[model samples]
Target: MCKILFINNCQLYFIIYISLPTLEKDNEIIDIDPFTVFGLFNKSSMKEINRKSIIKYIADEFNINAKIPTSFNSIPVLNNQNATFYNFIGYRNDSDIDDLWELFSSALDYSKNPTQANRDKVSKFFDRVINQKGNGNSKITMGLYWISPDTFLNLDSRNTWYIYEAGKIPDNIVSILPKVEEKISANKYFDIMKKISEYLKSSASNLKNFKELSFEAWRYSEEINHKEKSKKVQSQRDDKGSGLADEDVDTIHYWIYTPGEGARKWDEFYEKGIMGIGWEKIGDLNQYSTKEEMKKAMKEKINPNGSFMNDALATWQFVYEMKKGDIIFVKKGRTQIIGRGVVVSDYYFDTTLDSEFPNLRNVKWTHKGEWEHPGQAITKTLTDITPFTNYVEKLEALFSEDNDGEIFKEQEIEYPIYDRNKFLEEVYMDEEDYDTLLELVRNKKNVILQGPPGVGKTYAAKRLAYSMMGVKDQTRIMMVQFHQSYSYEDFIEGFRPSITDGGFEIKKGSFYNFCKKAADDIENEYFFIIDEINRGNISKIFGELFMLIENDKRGNSLQLLYSNEKFFVPKNIYIIGMMNTADRSLAFIDYALRRRFAFFEIKPGFKSKGFSIYTKQLNNKKLNSLIECVERLNNVIADDETLGEGFLIGHSYFCNIDEVNDKVLSNIVEYELIPLIKEYWFDEPSKVKEWADYLRSAIK
Candidate 1:
């Protein structure tokens, strides 16, 4: 007899649930009869049928006609009698059966008897399969022969074998499979397909390999389709305004995407959610209300006393025409009461004064059976009343009894103040004896500092600031280099649109800030140092300020459009500019800037005390040798328009200790001096070669 037991926590719920009526001895077990617990009954009782025969019967019912091997071999048993007799007949271990099933399933040939065309077709099928599946969130299910815990794991290994054996799968498909699997596990449906597609299109070889067909299966997954469903929600919203009724006003809140600095303002508006217009966008005057309730709320919150009664009365009339949530501007010079109190309230009549109450002055209040004298009520003003009604009537007109039409408007405006005296006195230099120099600058002070290379035309600008202002701090001096891209906006104020919640708001530029800073500090001298002043789009950079740079127009005030900011260059602010004549490609300095700033030719001053001390340390023989070579080259370059006096080697050359070495000297000859000579003396290579050879010899 064969017995089956169902055990939960070592406690048998049922013993001998089902038994096959067979052998005589109850102790002699023919099979473990694992399925006896299932209690599957057949009407036909076959006393001689083995476990393999029973399995074959079940397989036939399932339409699986594959052959089954006997006697617990590695091959699976298809026939019921054989499976029961050999594998499940007596005391069979479930673990052994599971392992056998896995081995059999893995060994099954999926590509058996496949023709060349069939192989190509499979490859093509998987190509599309991988592409579509890889690009989307989809799952491909391959039927497994078993249902053990390792079924999927076994299936995965089989699938990998099929993909690798196919060999025709694109590299991209193969590469993207692992990533797709990872994405699937993470449940990132949308990004999975996107990432897969990106990998397929990318130059990476892993994605190009089609060996891994799993990516193709994942691309077609249903989850990916769901992820792509709501991609255009925002676009749809933009296409159709808020779905509020035609009669009803819809408040559509939108965020302005400003590129760079505007991002901050856009975020602010998004967070604040349409709290009137951004202050940076508009001027001081602002309005708030879209509906009547909001307006009434504003009136209650803002307006209290019924003063300047006529304007308040007019506002009330305006409110009647306003729709719910409709914003309207309150004209200037409205009733003081409406202005003082942001809202309007109930209306009442006073009968104390009877002299034709249409004028507010004639209106009065009746108190305790006694008439109070009235000209303008203490609570109200004469201006508060209108010609059409008394103070009470005017107050009623201004005050909205019901909260109906309300509007909210933000005024975008900014007032930038520039201090004139403070800027000049602080930024400019002024001492008792040098007061005359400041005066000279006010009238005519044309000063220039000339020096050799490294002698520092650039360095002295800072020193000049110190000499003029007696302040060693370099921050007090403003330094700007002239470049072709440098514009007036960089040197002066210009309208630059900034992104605000409402829209683009124009703001001031750098020059405006600098001038504002200078304007605030006028007690000392301010030095504006322009390095490489000639190499710029001078007219474009200066704009109209080119004319204002003159002495006469120094104090003339100017206003910028975006901001109500007034600016003026003070007389005390001295303009010191440096120009390197060696840069032949640069255009001539702007005549306007030239007139404002003193032109100083900073040539190689070899005779200067600084240069003398710099050269005195050099060996006499080397100094003389260097001088002889420079003189010879100077003569050769004297007539060349491109190679002028600036090309001459300056005394600073001898000051550098490294330049004395033979290798460095040869490099100077080969790299710097030779190239320069070649560019300038193209037709005279012999002369160039001679000069180079002489310099090389002198250095050696």
Candidate 2:
């Protein structure tokens, strides 16, 4: 590499630009892709990266053990104990260490000779370890840096991405770094970082060290900051429009996204059938544990305004929260709707994508043209408009005009698998009990799972249907909660106000529509789950359909009071109702309704093999003690004349928790269990406090 020359002519300055020679070692050509990273946490905030301390800790701790030649204790273990640190990536657990230690030890030799041949060996070793193929490159580079920080810089994804953003990387770099999971030789990785670092150092006026170069790379890399934001140009298209066939309006989430200012990316995204966003510097967002972590990375690399919490949140939601089948209303400028799309795929970070927007999701663009929203939409990059039902309805109505009353249909079926075994593990129930419940539903056609709170009644109802159906099949399952105000008008067809009619139009209720859908597909069984079934006035809600719910009368046709049309409960439809027996405000189910449907008592299963296995696997003394105490309390409640077994404390409160710790136990005791206990024994204040103290002490 040629040396850059600087000449001082009086007080003025003259700088010379020189293209460096190709780096060679051992008579071999050295090639490394440009704009690859090392680090960038904005030195000022994360504490300056200490060079001497990092090297010293590596020398002391990371040296190979003679007893286990391929092993060098874990870096994360030292991190757990607050040992001296280095900021790097890809060592999530000790497995990566154990998997790559043989390759990792080679760094000591590479540092000694620092040959191109040896550097190539590290990358080749990574590919050989097939288990680590995805994250192999990350480990090798950081592992090499750990041994010799100065000789081999740790260019993490964040660092490489920033260098790309700074425009230091040539266009050809994409051919080399083709995907997020790029595998480059260690020789090439170091060569590229050295070239970029040297170039950054030579170009600056007062840059002192490599750390400052990191800060400069971060500061200079820019686009679409608040200052460059375009002025609002309202869309000239008319506000009113129409949409296509409606399905699952309640489940769909509506969103608005801009390809770029004035819809510059419309052609690319529309033709490719995709929608995407910038902020490619953060790498694959899935790696971030939470939205807050994604936001933190955005702050250091993208320099997003910390005060704009919603703006920061949009970046994370774009990758993780956005789901397939969600609606997207594409907009150009403020209030201008350019297109409508349905998400067809999950978010992916494709490095080969258009560099401007590397994060993407495949979309089926249904409509493309100019239309205006009834109101000015949120100006954020992405906005969830599902809450604005009226606005969404109007938007759909506008799209309905495109075909001039002629419309087409598009169907996408997604059946997530949830079989009987999964149901057994999750519901804290055994095979015999599960078989009985399924048989009861099939025989009775309508059954209520009556249990105390935390017995997993509602949880089991959905899964029971899943196990019966053999697939999750959300399309076949419909769940609705019934309350005091629920009625025939809400559960069946009813007249409601319409904008165009300027009068009332018959609007179909959720259950009525679901029944119609099920009736159309008579061969397949459909399950309808009603939560808090006892809360609503059953006679008022069911109306004439009350008699039809009986297994024999299911296929019998009935005339509706409102529409006067022949409607029959499909023979294939089954009902699963849930009743919280602990709710004392209500009386027993009507005798007329009770006899038609089977009532299944779902008891607490603390002693069930599933629950026992779950508890042992968690292996927490506090959790074990707490469960034993709850069991004793359940016995006391069962014996009480006022409460009995129906209102006993359930085991669901402790089920499926990720871990049993003091914080979780305390929350359950203070907020969940204690409140229920206070309500259960309201007449006896001392008793309530006694049980509360007992439960609290069990965890403590």
Candidate 3:
């Protein structure tokens, strides 16, 4: 016997041996059941899939006297035709059927006789299998194994990987078996299967078929992949605390869930404070280790028509993807929102509940009364609508009246007193410059604050609005970031999936809704702030609003493309946009937009009285030394011909630290500052290294 270690770190090995002595020579009785291995692989950790019944159904379809089909898809695996699963298992070919009936009859003959001539003739179809969809193995090979699991082994990639290269590759296999990569001839395949049968018989008097073992091999490969995926989503869970506040709410998944048809289970779920999904016959969703596995079971037992894709996805998300504190918007049909809540418990399978809907999760339903939906919710049973902020906001609006504070407690917007002095003190900007910014917005209806990153551009923009109003009113402010994908449809108004009828409808955009809100309160000021304003196609995003956003065009109406409604930029709406000058990729502002708005430059405030006073209060000697180094570095950046004052480091990087410890300072140098330095002087590696060393030494 020889043991070969394929992966040293994992301690994985594949053993090769000539043969093993029979169990009769040993002291103990042994059991060689592939089904046992298969069960252990999936059933021990999760719910067991009914593999036997499905195998029985498939085997029954290939009986010797079974009628031949016109096309391979005419053969039903779990009563579904043209399923991609058949292609994956290498059972169905998309093409290459010259005479379907004759080929079927020949395959049956080869399975029964197992003669070299029959094998030679039938194996010809192996390469002819269209694209060799999965495993790249002969479909005939898989079929024969299904027909006689004990006498034949599929030898697909899944089976071979488990045996030769996968984690702790199976031990004590007979010699002369095919290599892992070799596509065995029929005789070679028979010899390998016979060896497997012999190895099993040696352990016990009773023998089981290799069908269960084949399933086990597939499970082994599947489990490894599932574990890797589990690791990636671990951060998505807030295992400690109630998943509330900024500490725990790093990422929140917003979901829309429906209680059975017409929300028949709404009362039961609301009363019980539990949400549930059906497909009980497939057993606990936990049994299926992955969504693909759950989807397979759904195809087999529940939705055989293969419409189960979306339902299975929703089921999998409910069981695994969803974490506590994720919002769940509940609705009955298309146009009505029935309730809103936060998921408060991990998923559970309750057999006592309606069997059709056994999978459940506990929910703290904040509101239960009906409210007219602004648009038609998706037709799916469960959907993750986190990406659609407009849709999520509109749905959240319906619950504002009945909101019991459970969901919005953390989001309770604060209207802290903010004015000219407060802004100057915090933003590190002098009163004169701050007043200039305020006047720019007052005169030009639209003003963009452009500066290097971390210059307090966004910060100062917000405070400028508050000072202009003489009070910080979050209700009068709206903020969004512009990306390469931001469009007029997203920024203003365009057709989205209809909320009332599941078709396209003119769903109002954020700016349009904010404008309406501001229009109603004409006496108060409303600020619409766009961060990273130059990242998007300004002309495309502003669309027809370019003219309306002009100081003179306020309240001048224009027909919208989709709704054709006479929409106008409300006079009370003040547009405050921020752009990063250091971003080399930003294009010049749209010429049309440039004419309508005033542009203000914001330099770093490191030398200002406010920043000096603030840093002196901290009294960190190392921080002051670091600031001196940054000031020196900023001089070189400003003097560089390719770069300018826009590329200078901003004071905000040093602003937010409550504790000025060496570790935090070092992190800012190594992780944050060094990366930016490298990009700033990308061609000058020595310059990057010198400054990098200079910055790191100050922290030390």
Best by lDDT: 3
List ranges where model 1 is wrong by over 4 Å. Answer: 1-455, 497-507, 561-564, 587-589, 618-624, 639-643, 652-660
TM-score of each: 0.35, 0.60, 0.49
lDDT value, residue 576 of candidate 1:
64
Ranking by TM-score: 2, 3, 1
What local lDDT score does residue 651 receive in model 3, on the 0 to 100 scale? 89
For model 3, the run of ten residues with the poorest summed lDDT: 1-10
Clashes of each: 112, 13, 7
Candidate 2: clashing residue pairs, number: 13
Give residue 668's lDDT in candidate 2 (0 to 100).
Answer: 86
TM value for model 1: 0.35
lDDT of 2: 0.66
Best model number under TM-score: 2
Residue-wise lDDT of candidate 3 within 41-106, one digit each (tens)?
A: 112222233333323333353453544232221111211122111222134443433322233455
Judge candidate 1 against the unseen true structure and give its global Cα lDDT, from 0 to 1. Answer: 0.39
Candidates' C-alpha lDDT: 0.39, 0.66, 0.68
Question: RMSDs, each prediction?
Answer: 29.0, 15.6, 18.9
Better of 1 and 2 by lDDT: 2
